[model samples]
Target chain A: MAGGQERILRRRIKSVQATRKITKAMELIAASQIARSQARIAANRPYREGMQRIIREAASADPAAARKMLATPEKVDVAIVLVIVGDRGLSGPYNSSALRAGDRLVHMLQHQGTRVRLFTVGKKAPAFFRFRGLDVEQSFTGFADRPTFADARAVAAALAAPFVAGEVQQVLLVSTRFVSAGSQVVESEQLLPLVMPNDMEVAAPTGLKGYTEFEPEVEQLLTELAPRALESEIFSALLEGAASFHTSQQRAMAAATDNADELGQTLSRIMNRARQDSITTEIMEIVGGAEALRSGK
Target chain B: MASLRVEIVTPESALWTGDATGLMARSSEGQFTILPQHTATVGDVVPGVVRVATSSGEVAFCVHGGYFQVGPGEEPGVTRATVLAGIAERVGDIDVARASRAKETLEAQLASPGDLDDLSRAQLTGALARAELRLRAAQH
Candidate 1:
């Protein structure tokens, strides 16, 4: 190998060491954030489930009154899509997957002649869409990693505005859904006018006879409950996105740390071999010279 | 002949869960009460205080908005209501400065001329309103 090759190897080793230090620090930081994100997820679960159940029950109670809000999409003209992603990326495909999914959806909608008005959450969405020449109607970043309910409400409001103004026919939410520590899937959900969850889940696993009467009529209840339902769903989605973001970062950092370690080991091995070769050459020369001197004497 | 089981769950945590003698909640129609063996009723919970009487004592919680379901059957009294944002405890537990900070941010947003959109401003107002109520309740 050229002498410069050893110098380059030394430089690479140093670089890897620095990268390892950074990755190790990031890994620890993300690992700590995971617990908080998990806790936030856990804390919000009861509310979302309860909201879902209430919406289901309320819809079942008055199917006629709920018809306007709980609509099955027949045609789409203008769709407002909300994409939830992280502001910063080092998290492997966490940002890319969401960005790609959103792009695909936008393209699909445009192909169908549907006007796509996009509202992006997280820092990455704006840049991603801009790169592809897609216009983002609104973008909110810095809240994906540690989102609060207020953030969700802000997003929900933005989605609902176009629907309320008749500018958009349907509202869709694009987000990463966290299934488990090791599994997360990006999905696009309808987020406007508050559609009812499936009947199968709402019928209360225990089918005991039940009758619930409302005093002010079902429409009024729907009016109040529908908005809250949307808020809950959005909050839950944010929580999932946050959990997924942290998990992805932790995993990516760990892989980086491992690669740095492997590279470090390889460099050390090569250095050791080089040192051995030089020592052997020196010993051989010494022996040859000693033999020559002995013979000459 | 039986007691009512009441549950008030907030998004952050299950705020209140236990058996109750009677309780009155501000419903969409009006104020409604639930006692032992009350009629089965489900209605929208408005933004107000819910007073629940239990063995410990009568306690009240400020609920943003939600829905409740009460049974008509003789299955004792089962009433479950869940609110996404409610104060189970009082402002007593919250730090004065922190609560004021939340209030200040909300008030400032409300006063700002369209810095935030209408919906976010509304949410901020609502949160601040709730925080203010908590502070008031704590003083008493």
Candidate 2:
């Protein structure tokens, strides 16, 4: 029942309350960003789908030539892995999950005796991989939160060079995919050796099938479409990663805010109890002194 | 007179979506114009101006490399023209000064750099072309 103890508890409660405010504000901001990222993803869909459609048509035009060369390579030698994470932290395990998945993939490739070139997007990936003695071939940052098509093209160029030069056999991407508002999963997908969408193959527009002619030869068209397709895929991954990051951050901040609130409540209760005890002790002391004075009289 | 539903979409946003009596686009083969009832076709869009004649007036768009598709719509003899641009800017929204500065910078970079790799040089050339097209579209 010490007055000093009561004051210390009050101060601790005040700090907890202040922290709760910050976490709450961060939660709101992350929530808003999730909505914005979702909108961006929706807007980009038509362009991405259109690119895919064109590539599919070109590939179908001469499946033997285009698919045989562009779709798959016969052997495996060098592999390029692009790992995407968020630039900032406090997003729960969003960055760490993707990095961890990427690390496992890298190690697995190394065990297979394949040379792996690591390219990272976002600040977290480079630092995380570098700390583990992994060499990052290239790193891009400063726009993971809201990536532009130009950023995607730049990244695609870096990834494409090795493959185009016959240096890398395959390209893989690791990132968190935003499945829905409530669910996000870390995944690794193949980027190189383009996998044509099933719908693209099945639903070839019959009317436009042989009528629509390519400016260049279909093989040449496939060559031109490859880079753009890769760019769009990377861009989509970035957009999904950004949305997933925001969703993770919002949830993490909300949980943290709730924990802070609980801590504040517990501290307040303890502080109130201490104050009550101190007051009771003070009143007892006054009563004791009065009793003593009255007894003496 | 029939009209076609036109949509100009970029990755960032949908720049324009409306009905147009006619539209002109530059493809890899050459420049072509689409009037109503154009047959179903798909072509590679080159970087340049895309002009659309709407009910109000003619509007211009600066489009980067993309795809153009004319597909049959729900109604018979009605086609939907979709321009899926990697990047697109409305002529009205174009900042003439900014585009000019960008073009100048790209030109300078393109001229002074023998050290640039072929790929980088080509990218720069493409960017310059896009900037020039933007400026041109803005002017008319």
Candidate 3:
């Protein structure tokens, strides 16, 4: 029986080692992706900041016109919630945290008596929402790991059409924001009405107030800039989400690998003790048999 | 002496950034050029060639629809001009073969115009326009 126990322990240790190999490999891959995604975020910084600056300039030039497009609507009959998450699982709470935030946002909106249209950006979102009796209008998949500007454009188009057509008055986004390598926070914010820069974190210094000149005038420029600004915002959000996903995945896989190592060590120690016990039993049986033979002789 | 700093940036990356004598691009209003000491101007850049004249030579970029901002730079008398494009590339970097092939394919798709949805059709037209711009920019 002890020998059998030893064999079982050996098999389990082998399995743990195999799983550790997989986790270690995954950790390395995710680590590599973290750097690349971070670089992409850096590359996109200028464009995003420039777009924001231009918006700020236009918004400052004509506050009334800006209010028409940027102000929150008083009566919201319908709203769209866009949730971004990872395509794959096993990335710790990266996917679940965002999904839960989105779920809560949808519930809160429903409590206000507003009709909710749900749109998701990952393969894992639809099932989670549908199981809760929520209807998912559209789900974009297959590009969560590495998103392109085109992907962001597609998402922006989908979200903007209803807003432009007056079918939806508000657009809300729920996703993870990558603040740094060690910090990522799940945040929910408004996508439509363009969230004026003054309300944003890095409010422009408001230099040269009305001195900036607009070619076709500020009103028309802001109108044309709205959708482009939306695209830029979505693109940056997607980039941050990707970086967070990779970082979260790398940390999770590293933890899993450590757990496997601990499990393997514990299992092997038990197996060693079990083998020693089985050897002791065999030795005692031999001595007992020899003593009985000697007495019989 | 006054100086100009030009930056051509896209969502993916900054295509070009350097000191230049002049920046030339067409806005919806008309053809315009930004030189040192230019006034603060914000405008949309139509999809076409954007030229930057440096002291050594001139460089061209094939910019699909985007926006531009001309304002004062960090140091006094240094004008900063920033061009933000959703998609753009250096004219010299444009692939002629690929652009022509894409143009041909898009034209064929448009000619047939099967049950393509409104969104896809619009996207196709946009792509065609970019391809044509790239080809036209590369020609010169």
Candidate 4:
């Protein structure tokens, strides 16, 4: 019985060692990915700032022309929601958090007598919603890891089409916002008919702040600013999400590696003890057999 | 000084910051010109040539539609306009072979017509625009 137990312990030790090797490799990969994601986030900032400044300039030029572009429907009967999440699992609760928030928002909107239509942007969301007996308008996969501007534009047009033709009163986007290296929070933002937040435009940085004269008219310029504003917002969100995903994955991998190391240590101790016990048993059998031979003589 | 302080920016980096004699741009309404001490205005740009009438001569660039802001903060008389041009590239900036290869790939994809849905169509168009920008700008 003891020998059988010893054999099992030895086998467990080998398996644990193998697992440690995998976890350690994953940790390294995630660490490298974090740097790339952060670089992309940094590069996207100037474009985002430029887009916002232009939007402000346009809105200021002609609040009237902006009004034509920024028309808000009186009552929202139908609404489109874009839910962006991750494709794969294993990075804590990144996808689940978005999924739950999206569901809750949809429920709240429905309660307000507004019809909510849902579009998903990751692979994970489809099965999750389907399992819960919810209908998904569209779920696009394979783009979550590396989202291009075109991917953003595709999602944007879906939400915009309804609002543009009076199908949706409002369009909202739900995504994860990367606040810092150590933290990320899920955020739901308005995407269409940009609500011009006062005081932000005047707070411009690195902008040709002190100069610029409009040639034709102010209102005409703001018209161009609205769509560009939406595009910038989407672009920034994608960058943030990419950064946050890598950060979370890195932390998760580090933890996994540590756990694997601990398990390996425990298994090593068990394996050593098993070898010692098996050797003692072999010695006892040999000594017993010699004593029996002496008694027969 | 020709008032339009033309500033062109691409996604990768800023291209040019200089003065122009007169600026002609393609807007949503139509082609419009910006002159020194022009009134405050905003406009939507369509893809076309941006003609900068400079003191020495005129220089034109193949420009994609973006946002242009004139007299953002100035008090009307002093023309301080900033054009937040989008994806502006010198014809000489792009490598011909690379752009051509990209175009060929896109054309093949279009010809094969696999899921040439709205998404694919937009992707192809973007490829064509980029190639055209490179070819047109690099020629001169």
In each prediction, how many residue pairs overlap at the backbone (N, C-alpha, C within less than 3 A)? 1, 0, 0, 24
On DockQ, who's better, 2 or 4?
Answer: 2
> What C-alpha RMSD separates each model from the true structure?
3.5, 2.6, 1.6, 4.9
lDDT of 4 at B2: 32
Which runs in model 3 stand beyond 4 Å of their true positions?
A200-205
Candidate 4 chain A weakest lDDT stretch, 10 residues: A203-212
Best by lDDT: 3
Ten-residue segment with the worst summed lDDT in candidate 2 chain B? B70-79
Write down the lDDT that model 1 would get.
0.78
TM-score of 1: 0.86
Candidate 1's iRMSD: 2.3
TM-score for chain A, candidates 1 onward in order: 0.90, 0.95, 0.96, 0.87
lDDT of 3 at A145: 94
Q: Which candidate is the best by DockQ?
A: 3
lDDT of 2 by residue, B33-58 (tens): 98897865667788888999998999
DockQ scores for all the models shown? Answer: 0.54, 0.57, 0.84, 0.29
TM-scores of chain B alone in all candidate structures, in the order given: 0.75, 0.86, 0.98, 0.77
TM-scores for all candidates?
Answer: 0.86, 0.91, 0.97, 0.80
Prediction 4 global C-alpha lDDT: 0.70
> Can you write out model 1's per-residue Cα lDDT over A195-262, one digit (the tens) per residue?
65665344644322566566667777777677778878888889999999999999999999999999
- Give the alpha carbon lDDT tens digit for every residue of B1-140 in model 3: 79999999999999999999999999999999999999999999999999999999999999998999998888988999999999999999999999999999999999994999987899899999999999999999
Candidate 4 wrongly placed segments (more than 4 Å)? A67-74, A197-224, A288-297, B1-7, B10-41, B49-62, B70-86, B98-130
Q: After superposition, how far is residue B58 of candidate 4 from its true place, in Å?
A: 11
